[model samples]
Target: MSADEGARHPEDITVPDAVSAPDAEGRPRRVTRRFPLFTRDTARPEGSGRAAPLDAPAPARQWPILAVLSLVGIGLLLTALDVFRYGTLLIGVALLGGAVLRWLLPGVGMLAVRSRFTDIATYGVLGLAIALLAMMAQPDPWLEIPFLKDTLHFTVSG
Candidate 1:
């Protein structure tokens, strides 16, 4: 027996056929059958692969959100200047405005940080609470809340 007729070694094994099929032109084309690294589809949901169009314009109502936020900032500035009454009022108004925007408009762009009902309820409640608090503040409160005056009496002996 010659060297060719001897027992076949593992290194001498050869693939019987080409892995890839040729194109219409009949050239030897490399076909790749890629198996995904991850077995499950982890990238995103199946149908939501496409991205939004670049040319789509943003909603026009987004400006109101900015205006409301600016109002809150102005309120902060006023508070820093010792005008707590007007400052707190302004903050409340801004929050109320945000609530209104969320309520009236379907899409508030960046302002839609939470669900519609949640955002509206939060803004409205918070705004009303702040406004009420501001009205009941010390020194010279604007509106005298009826029962709150007697309810908030706390005496501490030094």
Candidate 2:
């Protein structure tokens, strides 16, 4: 046999496991496992290419993610400075902006997390939820639900 014939490919050669299954009838069998796409490959999300030209700086290349992160950082800072309602609203707005950028822009850098639809759904839903919660926060809520208090009281006190 030629040297190429003596050298078997990894996938072509399979050794059996120590233990045998009832279905194997005591014969040795090759054990192989399949991996999902994420494990096998790390393809970028759709429209996740650089937002700016290659000649631009790194920050420019990834400005979309930077913008969202900066807004979130500012929101946290505002929250620490005792501006809870507006701070939370700003954070929600940041997420909404990410969703919008992902939707409208052809290349959003790292802002595109998953597929276009999935990223939009995730960001939009989280942003809406946070914004609604901020509007309904305690002490003097802007959008109070009349039945929510009753429901909470019933669940807690009943």
Candidate 3:
């Protein structure tokens, strides 16, 4: 609203004293300020920083994610080339590696997708599940569970 309009309507939300007060940053502090629907400023997730110095090349600065992505790409190629089990295992290992990087490194660039704990948990759980499933897949499974076999038989038989 215009200053004249606010002056006319004293009952409006124009807290003259509070709005004029300077904050630590010297910006006007609004006492009755509500959160904006969309924030203009956002804090980066923890560990989301360049792996290399600012002067380094883009690839070097973002090497952590690049490494993970490269592994995943190779895994996809292997899967396409008919090495199903190994390819899936490789992909899972890549995710697990990403989790390890996030945990150990102080900065991981784009590898830091979310909060450290959440990212680690997500990557670890998904990686382990994929690897375990790959190990148990198809004819002559590597890690067999008799109970699972029975349950599968029962469900299909029914």
| lDDT leaderboard ranking | 3, 2, 1
**Cα RMSD to the true fold for all candidates:** 14.8, 11.4, 6.2
lDDT values of the candidates? 0.72, 0.87, 0.87
lDDT tens digits by residue: candidate 3, 66-101: 999999899899999999889989999999999999
The TM-score that candidate 1 achieves is: 0.58
Model 3, C-alpha of 104: deviation from truth (Å): 0.6
Off by over 4 Å in 1: 1-61, 154-158
Lowest summed lDDT over 10 consecutive residues: which window, candidate 3? 9-18
User: What lDDT does candidate 1 reach at residue 61?
Assistant: 34
What's the count of clashing pairs in each model shown? Answer: 0, 0, 0
Best by TM-score: 3
Candidate 1: the clashing residue pairs are none
Whole-model alpha-carbon lDDT for candidate 2: 0.87
| Residue lDDT tens for model 1, 76-110 | 99999999999999999899998897777655666
Instruction: Give the residue spans of candidate 3 off by over 4 A.
Output: 1-34
- Expressed as tens digits, the lDDT of each residue in 16-128 for candidate 2 is 54243545476545434634223335888999999999999999999999999999899889999999999998999999999999999999998988999999999999998
**In model 2, which regions exceed 4 Å deviation?**
1-40
Q: Which candidate would rank higher by TM-score, 1 or 2?
A: 2
